[model samples]
Target chain A: MKTTPLAALHESLGARMLPFAGWEMPIQYQGIVAEHKAVRESVGIFDISHMGQFYASGNSVADWLNSLLTNDTGKLGDGEGQYTLLLNEKGGVIDDMIIYRISADEFFLVVNAARIDEDWAWFQKHCPADITLRNESDHFAGVAVQGPKAKAAWKAVFPDCDLPEKNGILEKDDWVVCRTGYTGEDGFEFFSPADQIETWFQNFLDAGAQPCGLGARDSLRLEKCFPLNGSDLNESNTPLEAGLGFFVKLDKGCDFTGSDVLQKQKSKGLKQKLVALKATGKGPPPRGGYDIALPGGEIIGQLTSGGQSPVLACGIGMAYVPIELADLGTEIEVVVRDRRYPLEVVKKPFV
Target chain B: MNVPDHLKYTESHEWIDGSEVVTVGISDHAQEELTDVVYLELPEIGRTVKKGEAIAVIESVKAANDIYAPVSGEIVEINEPLGEAPEPVNNDPFGDGWMFKIKTSNASEIDELLNADAYRQLIS
Candidate 1:
């Protein structure tokens, strides 16, 4: 398995390592609960180098990206980034990515590690001379500092470094800092040289930032009801059905590749939607692939993700159920280890 | 990491105290490995258990695990406190975190279990 530059540091900190999305990443240090609570209460840092990066240059870059992604790329100014989705011909989400506009003719795309090859090949298949795409995944290291006290810990290393207060972007030295995160916490994502990542990580840790792992990251995103690319949204699910329609710009008329099918789906309305559920009692945490049942004992949907939230102190999950049964306060059942537990469909934002 | 000298152990990582009532729970090493205990399901107090049968279920943050019986017995009492707060298993697995108390049907069954030193070598 490939290791990040902080592999030695993780081992020294007694982390439990596990293979994830093609890299050996720390699954937990101390423990998932302790690390998770630390992030919710204080600050946590994560090595996000396993994610893929792409550089798009040339004059046609913006126009080419505008036709490929679901969101409008023409609206992004220099040094701005927007969350978007690359969809298949059927309007199903192939991958979710952040498109960063580096200049009038250059852009940076950060995508899921598992979808890097597929996304790169898809981009190459439709490339024109006006756009030059290069896979730059190995050239940089990314670190995320999140939670309430994240800014304080990060400020110790680069006191003059100022992160964008909004979802825009800022350049710090040779690095890029963005004030956005998958976790529902105030944080900044730093993209710097691979050799310099460890130095800054240690600096933040020494300033009282906790070392979080994949486990805490998963829990944090789940609490925010953020859909993971493979788990909650996939090639078989449309962005509308996955509850990510807000990110898809249907009326912008950008002439994107998947615009026709997505517009049709939006007009026709979705059949199934992803909904959040809360367990009614203290029981075993629900798990993915568990069957969802109605009050009449009819199968309706299946769970995509479920766990006990250390921050919320309750059980929360995502499920794809029929639109009629997806309302808040709807009753449902989740089967765990051969026993069914009753649950209620709650409003979004499980936290 | 407490390994009670008087208790017996199993290769499956359970510890048993079989002098009178046979109290059983997971070993400290086992609990340490399954960190961040979240939810637990213990058998009813009057439930009869057979050797090697799963009597309780433990859920950590990562996954769920089954706790098997060390000897054939009837459960007499259970640590209900774990249902409210399961982190004690991570804090003190051998003492306050003991799972259940079982009244053994056959006292001779304890002889087949491994002692403290034997259990230490088994885990090692």
Candidate 2:
């Protein structure tokens, strides 16, 4: 199995290691609960170098980007980034991504780690003559310092590092800083050279940032009702159906892929939408694919992501429910461990 | 790593000792293997459990495991603190991490448990 620069560090710290995607990533360091609490209460550092990064540059970068993503690139100024999605002609999500416009002719695209090969191939096949795509996945490493105390911890490490002025990006030599994160918390993501990543990770730890693993990461993201790519959003899912239509630019006047189908769906209204639910009693967090039952005990939907909320002291989950039952405060039931527990539809942020 | 010399161990990885009644808990190795004990469903305090019967369920991050009864007996007491913070099993599995106490029907059943050296070899 592949390993990152921090592989030895994780082993030295007695991390529970597990195979993720293709890399042996740390599942937990001190413990999942401790790491989860640290991120929620103070600061936690995550090794995100396994995620794929790409640089798209050339004169046709703007037109090329406009042709590919569902969002309008015309509105993005230099040094700004936006969350967007790549869609197929059938309006299926190819990969949700973030686009960083570094300059008029240069942009940085960050895609999901599991979709590296597919996304790279798609960018290569669709590159316009005026633009070029460079795969920087192996050359760059990313680390995230996240939590309420993240800014303070990060400032101690890199005192000169410009605070994120806007959406998730800070400028450093050969490094890109962004205020974006999968966990619904205030934090900064540092993108730097692969070799220098270990140094940064140690620096963050020296500054008392707890080392968190994917286990804590999942709980944190689930607490925020954020969607995981494979479990929550897939090729069969559309942003409109997933309650992410705000990220789609159907009226941006750009003839991008999947625009027609998305516009048609928008006019007709969504049949299904992602909704957050909280379990009412003591029970395990609803697992993905667990049945969501109606008042009459009829199965209606299934959870895509679920976990115990360390902060909420109960089970919480996110799933696609039919539009009729998607209203906030709608009471429902979740079948977990062969038993049904009362649940209620709530707002997106379950925290 | 801290295997109390006074306590006997089972091959299934539980540790046992006798006070007025037999006290049972998972070994340190067991807790380390199942890191971050989130929720533990212990058996009823007065219920009689058979040896090797599933008496409790422990859930970690994404996995759930059945904790078998070490010796056939009536559970005299349960650890209520685990419901609020099961991490003690991860923090002090041999001491304050004791799961429950039971009145054994037969004292000879405790003799079947392995000694410290044998229990260490079983895990190693």
lDDT of 2 at A102: 83
Shift in Å, residue A105, candidate 1: 0.9
Candidate 1 lDDT (Cα, whole model)?
Answer: 0.84
Q: Which parts of model 1 are misplaced by more than 4 Å?
A: A171-174, B45-48, B105-109, B121-124
Q: Mind giving the per-residue lDDT tens digits that candidate 2 earns over A1-351?
A: 768778888888888889998898998888787898999999999988888899999987977898889888888888888889998888888889888888889998888888899999988998877788899899888888888888888789889765765464656778878878877777878878888888888888999899998888999998887778887888877888877877888777777888888888888988888888998777766677888899767898788888777778677888888888889999988886667888888887877
Model 2 DockQ class: acceptable
How much is the lDDT of residue A29 in candidate 2? Answer: 85
DockQ-based class of model 1: medium
Question: What's the DockQ of model 1?
Answer: 0.72
What would the TM-scores of all predictions be? 0.94, 0.89
Clashes of each: 0, 5
**Candidate 2 overall Cα lDDT vs. reference?**
0.84
Q: Candidate 2: which pairs clash?
A: A168-A178, A168-A179, A169-A177, A169-A178, A170-A177
